[model samples]
Target: MDSYYFDEKSKFDARDPLGILYKITFRLIQIKVIKMALIFTFFVHLIMNCLHFFEILSTFDADLLVKYGPTLFPLVYGLATIIFDLMFEKKTAIVLEETFSQMWSLDSTGSKTAKKIKKESKILIGLVVIDTILATVAIMFYLPIMEWDIDIYYAIRLFEMKFSPTMSLVFSILYYATIPVLFFSMLCTTFALFYIMSYEKFQTYAINDLLKNISIDYQKIDDWKMMRDQSYQNTMYKRLTICIQRHQLLKRMEVNINQIIFTPI
Candidate 1:
């Protein structure tokens, strides 16, 4: 609601970075049912991932671990992040909502800053897409077809699921579907961390400019007792207050990142 968000003022009303992710996160905070559903689905995916992890350990194949470790851990980290968010639902929502609102470009439409934001959005999205493509290719071609299981056999046995090749394939695909889901989840929360930190540099620049302008404007005043000088002083005081507030917010967000993000789930 403050002047911090250019999207609130932009011609389009909001041309959000990672627009899909922003809407989903924002809505998750507003809607209790959606939040609960998200938590349940994330928990289910985590259970599936754990089952596969158990399957890996069951094999006791060091070579298999070496082979699958890279792919498997991304799933683990991704789903773990989502599950952790469910665990700390309120704090997670606070951090995510703040991130969506604050890390976004404060530049309005058609400016160089806006264009730069667009390029950056594309690059980050491109990285996620490329990773997904490579992982898909590896799963389809390099990963042994026999090895790619969402522990489908275990599910069929446990549920007494109907058995047929078609059904089996369908079940396999459904369970393994967690890969993209988890990946996208990570993109929204965990993987976007670096992108968020990059915005801190902009914050630092803003702070510097604010301080410099305040100093310049204060010095420009000819008579401190005059009404004009008093008005100028009030304006500088407001800018200083905003600068201090932003600095403190950045510190809190940093601590949140260290605790919630760096420590891992």
Candidate 2:
């Protein structure tokens, strides 16, 4: 690999503001805090179901639990998988980062194509952040209000036990707080998944663009053959060789992406 692809001055360097932000976001999603929050959410549901099963909590509908509980499984599972990948697939992650860096470093310094890719990347990240914010708002505010209107709490029955006022307040606070934590974790994980998939697709497009450019170069070389200059032919052969290497590299990148990221997702 060329040193320029890994250059610290590159826009994709982790020290840059956007890169730092991306690293922090990825780290946050992979942390134990999100996992614990998800587990707590699951346990809350499980406890409610168990209480209803054992007749300890009255007014709990088993059918409602059955309907809502399974829906959360995908969220929990997806978050867990993302966490596992970040933790255990260090090599793959490094390759992904390098690939991103190389893509950003393409063309000469301050190239229009590089600027466009950077702009598109920023737009995608902005959209994902907006989606996460909107999802957080919907889950934290809208869903609860909707559920309250429907009296679905009677179905889950978290606070059915008669307790001391202090204990009741504590349980109420914990229960309400856990809802947002669980929801935020799930939303962030989902956004991360979408981001990864978008990035990989963008990479595929970039590779195709490079292949097209190489094809065009080959056509130009064919046109140059009318001049019949030996030196020009030698230079064309070298360019063709470089193009072939680039094609192979792209193929390897595609394979790595499928094996390391897409398959796992």
Candidate 3:
């Protein structure tokens, strides 16, 4: 923990601004509401992907496969990739907390927030373009597999299939459409993933920077180890300390205000 954080004046006092801030932060974490919500959503996405995968395998219909398979395969694979990548839950949480803090600390002046938002927005747009291209390529790879179905299904819709050339042309034209939508959906998801990866990088970078800034001699290996351990402890300890301060502040404020009102001049 930073010595400043525990200093007598800096120490969270019931009367201090930091004390109230800590309390609010603690309440948010205590309920574990955000954590629960994230877990619930992640599972829901996984279940939906599984359902899509099953639906594709269950149906032999070309139309159904063409309509659904493209999205379903990627959906399952993408969610699986994200889930696996997020195995480090503790580190991911730290990233989210850091992201939240960064956003919360942003100054509206000089378009700082705006610039950040714009940059993120561009990344999102790029993500959409990339995922769409990927899914579209996937669709094309599956097209050859659909050739046999056309022979059988064409007979049933022969008159409609008579427009086969037109349909083919149209399908080619609209092929790009499916991907853009998929791309956008995937892009939104990437934001969360990006934050997770980014936060871990930030933590590692901060630690490395700290080590470099300390012009320590080679004999001070223990000091370096202590610095690293201290950094990790500070992350957890600060949050807990904030919680404690919040509770203390609330109790102290009530008592102090009551004493002042009751005491003689």
Error of 3 at 76 (Å): 4.7
lDDT of 1 by residue, 1-265 (tens): 1123322221312545555444444345346654555565576556655665686689775754565565556656766656555555456457745744543343532344445666776786687678667656654542226663433234433233456777766655665554455544554564445445545554555455445544443454456454556676676667677667667767777788667655553
lDDT of 2 by residue, 1-265 (tens): 1111212233344422144334545666557766577567666645644554455336466665564454435434544544544443455456666665544334322234445557777787787678767777766552345534224442224454466667765776676666666556555545545555555554444444443453343355565563586765665466455445545555666577557555545
Q: Go through the candidates in order and give each one's C-alpha lDDT.
A: 0.53, 0.52, 0.41
How many residue-pair clashes does candidate 3 contain? 0
- Poorest lDDT segment (10 consecutive residues) of candidate 3: 1-10
**Off by more than 4 A, model 2:** 1-21, 30-95, 98-112, 142-150, 154-156, 162-165, 212-265
**Predicted model with the maximum TM-score:** 2
Candidate 2 deviation (Cα RMSD): 6.4
Give stretches of model 1 more than 4 Å off. Answer: 1-21, 24-71, 88-90, 96-105, 108-170, 215-234, 262-265
Q: lDDT score, residue 78, model 3? A: 45
Q: In terms of lDDT, which candidate is strongest?
A: 1
lDDT of 1 at 138: 55
Summarize candidate 3's per-residue lDDT along 8-67 as a digit string, tens digits.
Answer: 122212322122222322223234544454344456545545554564578655675565
Which candidate model has the greater lDDT, 2 or 3? 2
- Error in Å for residue 253 of model 2: 5.7
Q: What's model 3's TM-score?
A: 0.29
